[model samples]
Structure formats: C-alpha cells, structure tokens
Target: MKQGFRLIALLAAIALVAAACGDDTSDTTTAPSNTSTTADAGGTTTTTEEMMTGPTFDIGVTEEPCEGGSPDRGCILLGSVTDQTGTFAAASPGLLAGHELFWARVNASGGIGGLFDVDILDSAIVDNGFDNATHVEAYQGIRDDVLALAESLGTTQSLAALPDYIDDNMVAAPATWWSGWNYPESDAGLILEAGASYCVEAMNAVDFAVSNFPTGAATVGIVHFPGDFGEDYLAGVKLAAAANNLDVVYEQVTLPIALDPSQQGAIDAVLENYADVTFLVMGPNETATIVGTVAATWNASGTDPRPFIGAGPTWNSALLASPAGAAFEGGIYFNSAPWGPWATDTPGHAALRASAEAGGAPASNFVSAGWVEQYPLKATLEAAVAAGDITRAGVVAAANSLGEVDYEGMVETVADYSGNSIITSSVVSAVDAAAPDGLTLLAGPFTGPTAAAHDYTGPCTG
Candidate 1:
C-alpha cells in the first residue's frame, strides 16, 4: 500500500508537470494578486500576506466570484457524486442540501481566507445511483472540472474512483463511514472522512444494547449486506460481542432488492434465532421491512419482540410514515449514529438547524451527516489557502498535515490523519415521532469499552 501511494504520488507529480508544460492555457497556475483580510478563529483580524502571497492554485478554482457570492472573491468549485436516484435516494437530497448550506454559511462568513467563495454547484453534482460502475463514471465526468469532491456517497463507490483520485491528487469527503477511510495507505490519504466508522459504531451499538437491555449470556443476530459497509459493521459486532460475552447466533448476508423486497428471509432468520438483540447493516427500506415485519409478527403472536439496532444508513425518519411506523414507535428499534441527531445541542448543530430552516431543507440525520462531513474538508481547504498553495496536491498535503478539526461540539474533535486516530465514540438514538428527525437521543457521543480498548491497525473489512 505504501509503495502504491508513492507511485501514485509520483505519477501525479509527473502529470502536474506535463500539464504545466502543455499549451493548455486553461491549466495554468497563478497566484491571486490581490490582498484580502479575514478574521481567524480567534476573532483576530489578519492580512493574507501574514501567511504568504495568495495561493498558486490549479483546477476547480477561478478568479470569478461564485454564483450568488460577493464579486470581490474568487470561486472554489467542489464536485459531488451522490445517490440522487438509487436505493439511498431518499437520503441524498438532505445530504446535498447540508453540503450547500455549509458552504453558504462559510461564504456568508467572509469565505475561505476572504479570497474564495466555495461552491458545489448543482450542475457539477452527479448522481451515482448507488452503483459502483455509475459512481466511477460520475467521477470521471467531473474529475477535470472540479478542485475536489465535496461529497462521494458510498464505500465501494469511492473505492472505485480512488485510483483516479490519487492520480489526480483530488481530495474528497466520503459519505460512507467504512473504517478504511481513516488509514492513509488504504485511501491514499485522500478521503476526508468524518465521524465514527460503521465498524466502531457497531461495536458501540452492541455495547449499548447489552447495557440497556441486559440478558445474561445474551445472543446477537446480524442482518447485513455483503460488501464493505456490511462486512465492516459485522467485524465490529463480532469484536464487541466477544468482549461482552454475547453469542452471535445468527448472521444473514442479503440484499435489499432480494428477500422478496419485504426482507422476509432476514425477518425469518431473526425470528428463528430469536437472539436477544439484532443488529442491522442495510439500506433504510430493508431495515424498515425487517424491523417492522419482526415487530408486527411478535405482537400478533403475543410474543415480546427483541430490540433491533440499525447502523446510521439503515435509518430514515420517513419510515415513521410507512407501515413500519407503528413498529418503530413501539420501542423495538434503535439507531447508531456518527454524531448527534438534527436537534443535538451544540454550536455546529445549531448552525446546521439555522441553515436548514433558512434554506427550507428537510430535517434528516443524513442532512446532519452531510453538514458534519464537510468540516474536515473545510478545515483542509482553509489550511491550503493559509499555506499559499490551494492546488490539488497542496490540498491533499494540507489534509494530511492537520492534527485536528473543530466540529463545534457536533461530535468529538477529529484527530490527526497520520495514524489510526479516527474517532471511536458514537451516538445512540431511538425512534420518537415527535422529536426532530424522528429520533430522540438515547445515549451517545460515548465510546464503549470494547471500541475504546480495541487495537487500531487497519480497515476492519480488509
């Protein structure tokens, strides 16, 4: 992996040199010739010169102001490849809205280094359809037109475009929370991932289940998809189940499109195993199907239903309006999140809420996720601007050099990128029809003993 990264970096350097030497006037690198003033996080006024001459940037940046932005600043265009019409389609709009709102707020607050207003234009946004080939094609379509990807919405999808990202020195905020994003070698130091990974979240979820619903020698059943998303969560559950002395008696690897679209196979597996608790790592529709079916079955049979815990992506507040609505309201389901819900009490959450309200964006956990995911990228861009080199390679370097990023209390502060310093804590929530986003906080922003003690080495799926 190290060798691969070195080779990719070498090739990127050669490509940059070739582009610089070519007759392509559009590929030229130039430093901003104007002076700009900005207030630092400390609220102190600082001149751009204090850092360095304006950044020498290439690609995805222009001297022209962003759409709807002040004409005084240049525009930094970031691309996005997300699910707009796929299995996760219901969650994509909120995620994109969050990305837009975050940038809007940044532009309103004087933009990056007071020189560039960032934009993730809808025109540049591509729909990946939650398919790997579609994701690769979507990325290829916009690779040359953007500075970086503000969002790439799946584990396999991002992985498919990763080789190209490394070759282009493009940095992206991964929408998926696979544990591999935390490792530079795994992702070529390019994925600017936010929040706890599905791996850690699963571990914390298992611990939460055991602590809240104690059953001596409890048994656990896992229903998941087969790839990185599901496999990563499965790995974590195994670790936590071992630590808690819980028997994992059932495991089902299936797809949402399968199981008769009702997830009958999964529901039957859960019923047969009758584990004290079940963990789900699938799409929202599948989650609703399995959870609702199981709950309804138990109720009809006069049997008490066990709790069903879902990974972040497995939930959508819209489920409350489905036939699963009654089942969800019956306290048979819980969810593990990378951060607090939409109504979390924090400066960041407050800002997000304000942005959503002002923009009329839908209230959804995916929206909060979309907002939270941008913090690392925002910090990286700011670092690049401050270092006087907002080029593609410069952005990657800036991302790696950061020791931390402030999330304004939305989640724990992001640790440095040089090692496995990914946040381990997770937020746990339960269904609440009356709560914002239909989720009420149960416990969270907390790390389970298993996750806290687990050895950090590499991707769980790997």
Candidate 2:
C-alpha cells in the first residue's frame, strides 16, 4: 500500500507553474495561491481558505514515542469506560485494547512529556457493561482520580454522564457518533468527537446511492432503532432524501434493537415496497441478523438483489467472518469510518497490529478507532502540560483551543477540532472479501447534507 497524503476532498488546489521566462521578470519561482472558490447559499462565489488539512496515512505516533519505558515520572492517569458484558460487549475487547496499546506507546515514550505515566491496568480501565447506571457508577467511583477520560462508550451512557462531566469541567473522548456534538449551542466541546457523525454518514450514503443508480429517482427505506444514534441517521437520511428529491418509500422508526421475531416482518415491509436502497442503523449483532435475513429471504426460487446501506456501528469483523458475510456479500454497503481497516498498511495500522499480536488482544476495526481516540487526548493534554497547567479546567481550555489532531495518516481527512470540532467527512465503503475487515472504500471524504444543513438546536428526536 502506498503511504502518503491523498487529498480526496474538492479543495481545488491551484498549483502555479512558472515556465522559466527568458526575459527574466524574476529568477525566483512565484508561489501559487492556495485559495479556492466555493459558492455560498446566496448564489455568489467567494474564495475561502481550506478550513481543514488534507488527508494523510502516515501519522505514526504521539509527539513522543516512549521506547524502553520513559524516565521515573510520577503518574498521569487517563481512563476509559467501555462495555464488557452488555449489548456491545462483543466490541469492547478490541476497542479497549486499542486504547490500552495507545497509552502503552505513550508511556514507553516517557509518559505525557515524561512528567507522568498513564496507568491502564490499575484504575484506568472500567467496565460500563453498556448500562447507563453502570456508566454513572464507574465514572462516580473514579472521576476524581483520573486526569480526563480517554473514552466513554455508548450513546445513552455518555448522555447520562454529560451533566456530571460538564459540571466538573472535565473532558472526555466520547465513543458515540451522535450529531448533537455539532450543535453550536451545546457546550459539550469537552467531548472531542472523532470520525464523521451519523448525520453526515447518512447523507453520504444517499449521495453515493443516487450518484450510482441507473435511471429514475430512488426510493429509500429507513429502519432505525429508537435512540439518538439511530435518530441521528434517520434525520440525515430524511434530509438527504428531501434535498435530492428521493422518496422515503418505507420509513419504520421506533424499531427496538433486539433480534425480535418482528424484524423479519420489517424486512418484508421494505422489500415489499421495492425500495431501491435500504438504510440500517443499529449495533453489529442486529445488523448481522437483518442483513442476513434480507439476503436469505430476498430470494425464493429466483434472485432479486437491492442495495443495503448500513451505519458504522453496524460493522464488525466477527460478522464479516461469519455466515452473515457469506449471505450479504455482493449487495451490502457501509459508510467509511474515521480510520481504515486492520488490513490497511499504514504506519498506524502496522503499530496496532504489532501491539495486538504481542498483547494477544482481539484485533478489529474498533481497535483502530481506539487508537484514533487518543489523538485529541494526547494533543490537548500535551498542550496543557506545555502551558504548565494540568488542572481539570486547564485541560478543557487546552482541548477547546485545539483546531486539529493528526490521525496518523490512517484517516483520509484530518479532524478539525475548531468551532464545534465535528469531523463531517466520510467515504462510502462496500463489503469486500479481499479487504481487511471486509470493507472496500468507494466514494467520499464527502461532506454534504451534513449536520450543518440539519436542525440540531435541540435533542435528536428518536
């Protein structure tokens, strides 16, 4: 795999060529202007500097790479609360392993500027069990001990602990992709969100499907679970459909996440309606079942296949390696994540693989995400230490002041932490047997029909 910056966004970079003029107006080569013209809603075009940096796949490590363990520092504690026994338990091991290995690299480099070390084994890792009460209890038990949270998984559980984090002026790397973080009104800037939100992913999915469809306007079916995560996707699909003039032929909201016997009926309803595209928003387990059901039941004696679009949470390596992948091989699509798959050959992916292998951790895409999760935490905390202030509020200021964090070249788009600090770009990936984790990216680093276009003034209507 080629390792370098590959800009896919429509930045319109203007490279000026100086054909050595013999008359010699000036011997020095004139630098080309780096501005591009993008039209505003007013129908007038104006030049604007790129708000974000181009993509890269080579960000190797935190600023400091701790080799054979750093100097004798006191201790700098950063913690993460992940699900170990609940609905998302299947994803917890790999996710937590990523975070653990990230700090392991950091601690080896000399522990947060060589002043303090991160303790992932002791009080650093907590199990939320995907339960809100457990999340609250875990945070309450350890909030005062750690510097800031490295990760807090789950939408509902993170939402449950928001008040406490905000009240304490604490910062955390939220594991959820809820678009509410993009709201200008909400001061949850403390929660640094990595990757694109569900809203933008939905928009990108619709855009991809519409761009590739053969002839007439397409009809989209939206089957989502009842929560902010699913509703964020539902809201985006509705927005994209309305904007692109696509039909919401079958929209079934309030679907519980259980592998309920009623799921087959919902599958039947969408298929019966002849939706050109189906968008599913749920966890990996439910996704495996739904996708499997559609692939199996879509044919009786003959074969009729349609496009299946799924959100990021619906992806897992286990499912891809299971019977589910065999059933839904050709016609399934998943949106691109913040980071690439395990098979990606970038420096970051290589390090993660080596760490997982040495540590005997379950390697998956979530582990890559767990590694990406440390980007902002390291950036903001390092800035705080540099300023000689390690207080809770100091870390908040440092985090808020950050405008961008390196994704180690694994991510195509650099995360801009400015303003709302939401990374609003995603690629549409197809399921590929040859691809790592069974994902082959198609289109995007695309951003439109984003949260910027939606109404995030209030809570997501689940």
Candidate 3:
C-alpha cells in the first residue's frame, strides 16, 4: 500500500510540473541587453524584452551521508513537535497525516539522495498551548540528533525560544506567525511564516466586509480575548478599518484561553453596542459562546439584524454548527489558506484525500489546511536533504531557497520568500452556512499590485 501511494504521489508531482511547463510556450530566451533599438529608423526603440525563466531544481540524482547511528539504511532525521491536544489539535492530526503521505512517497521513490527517515517527537503541548520554556526544552531534547525541524505550531512558545533556536543552527520549515512575525533583519534566519500573519487575515477580512457587507453606519466593533492572537487581530482590524475609512467602535478583551468570560455583564456590554460589522477576534470556544450569547439575546428580543465578522481562527466548522452559528448568518472571515473542500480539483486536495483516507483521518474541509501544509513542509525538507548538508544552516537556506512554490496546485498563488518576512496569498470567504459548501470565497487572493507584496508590516501597532 505504501509503495502504491508513493508511486501515485510521484506521478502527481511530475504531472503538475509538466502542466506548469506547458503553460510557458515562449522560445527566444533573450539575454539581458543595455542599448535600446530604433523603431522608426530615427525614433528611439524600447529595450529588448527579456523572458523571465522560472526557478531550476536539482533534477539529477545525488547522494548524501545519513546523520544518525540507526543502521545507515538511507535516511535523515527531521525533527517535529506538533500541538496534538490544545487549540491547534483540530489541525494537528491532519498535519501529521500530510507528513506521513509526503515522506512515505519520498522514501518509496528512493528517498532524498537515496536516503530517507523522518524522526518526529510528539511535543505534548496541547489545549491551552505550550510555553516558551516548553518549546526550548523540546528542541534541546533532540537538538544534537536531527537534521532540521519541520513544523512547530506555537508562535508564542517558539518565539520565546528563538534565541537558542538560532544559536543551535536549526532551520525550521514553517512556524505559525502571530502579530509579531516581523522580526528585525538579524533574526531573518529563524523566521519562516507558512501562511500570512494573523493580522493580514484580519485586514483582509475587514477589507472584504467594507466592500460587500450590508451598508449601514459603517461603525465596526471588535471583541477579542486577551492573548497575542486575539490582541494582534483586534489591532489589525482597527488598522484596516482606519485605512479603508471605516468607523471603529467598541472593543473588548477577555481573559486568557477561556471560551467565554465568566462575567455575563461584560459580554452583554459588547453585544449591546454592536456596529454594522463586529469582528470576533477570539479563540474557537470563546467565539462560539460570544455568538451564542448574542444570538440568544437577540432571538429573545425578537428583532435586531447585525452582521458579525470573524478572522479565520474563529470561524471553525464546529463552532459555526452551534446555535451561535445562526447568529453569524451574515458573518464573514478572511483566511490565509485555501478553502479545503471547495478546492477538490486541486492537486494538493487530491494528495490530502489520498493520505487522509489511508491514515484513517476524518475527511473534512477543516483538516485540509494541515493536510496541505504538510506536503510543502515535506518537500522543503526533502530538497534540503538533497542539497547534501543536513546542518541547521542548510535547512534554513533550503527553506528560503524554495522559490515561487505551489503546493501540488492546491494554493492559489505561489509562496513568496524574499524578504525577512515570508508573504503568501490570502483568500476572502463569507460565512454562509446555507451554501452547499458552508463557506464561500468573496474576492480572492487579490494578488494585485498595491497589496502588501513580500513587505513586512511590523508588530502590533495598537
């Protein structure tokens, strides 16, 4: 079964590359020029237009030495610490499934440089999430053994241990970014945001709301929990609203990690002063409670129609299914990743389904992000191994070198990794439960000129 799946993955990747190559049908690989040519005998002509060549991969085969003592049977150890219990547990299992699929295929096809073995350590940081100390301990536990770290989800915990991580020379494939993704130029080696910062997601969601939501007073209210994730997003919504000329009204901060604040009066206060657009920048459980509270109150009054808007984290499939889900009838959100089920035709999706089915994961849209993220993570590490150097520096360099990457055609735009901050595309989707797919895209990747392209908009500005 593993061999068959690996074969399928290779064929899929080759098919994708072939399709992309076919899209480029130009010949004259023009070289760079200095002088301009004359168009009308005496008139000055524009400089010759040069065709841009895409990135080149090491297509040929190469071999490298294995790092560990485990019977040199062609393998390299890549470290991993997943949040399999806490807030991120929702996507943790699926992400692991993706890793399994990627490496399974890679090893089956003769491994990286004819060697393959991914050593993963279950970083037992679950529900409430891991602290900085825990993150450092986990890394220290296996620092001397692995070639590179694949995926570590906690931004706060990881950022806390960033200093040691850099000193140890570990190249992390992808890290979940909070508002503070923009570190100084010196820390560039340690930062590789897989998706857009949560702030970007907030800004995009606000932008979508302004253009599409039912027009009214234009006042906006943002409710958030008092954590890095919540605070950062709340700040982002305000910034986006200010730039877009939208009003900013009531804002609240609840306790840490509590789904809903114990104080009912506080919750009612925010609900009472609602605006045309309300941004719930809280975690999953709290988001559900807030929505449920509002819905129950409004339903009791028998009247009052207001649109609630939330960032991606708050828009969980389970939460939306709750009674509070009904309150968000006109709610909308901005997401950094593609809508999973909606993208059934994408290569990423095909690969994800194959892996999930094989691994016994529930085939749900929510699991697709972890599913797709794992593929690129795997491919990035494989490329690093192929480079013949498994040191921390090698891993980081390999990650940065991944140019214009498209995940099996799953992601809409190619990932851009040029500056200190990694920038990728963002998708705008509306929270419409009535639709066949539940959520729908409003405007899209908006990969236009004027949008922040590879530009690092620094930390929280509130």
Which candidate comes out best when scored by TM-score? 1
Off by over 4 Å in 1: 1-53, 214-217, 258-260
TM-score ranking from best candidate downward: 1, 2, 3
Q: What TM value does model 2 have?
A: 0.77
State model 1's lDDT. 0.85
Question: lDDT score of model 3?
Answer: 0.55
Q: What are the lDDT scores of the predictions, listed in order?
A: 0.85, 0.68, 0.55
For model 1, residues 1-462, the per-residue Cα lDDT tens digits are: 000000011111111112145464454433332334455565544233222235767789877889899888888999999998887888888888889999999999999988889999767799999889999998999998999998998898899989899899999998999999988889988998888999999999988888887553389989999889999999999999999998999889878553358677788899999998889998889988888888878989999778889999988999999988999998988899899888889999999999999999988998898899999999989998888778898898898897678899998886665454589899899999998899988998999999999988788886
Between candidates 1 and 3, which one is better according to TM-score? 1
Report residue 255 deviation for candidate 3 (angstroms): 2.9
lDDT of 2 by residue, 325-374 (tens): 77656555454455456766567778777877887776567777788777
RMSD for each model, in Å, please? 9.4, 17.4, 15.0
The local lDDT score (0 to 100) that residue 275 gets in candidate 2 is 85
In model 1, what are the clashing residue pairs, if there are any?
none
Candidate 3 stretches with Cα past 4 Å from truth are 1-73, 105-110, 117-128, 179-187, 257-266, 320-344, 400-402, 412-421, 431-438, 447-462
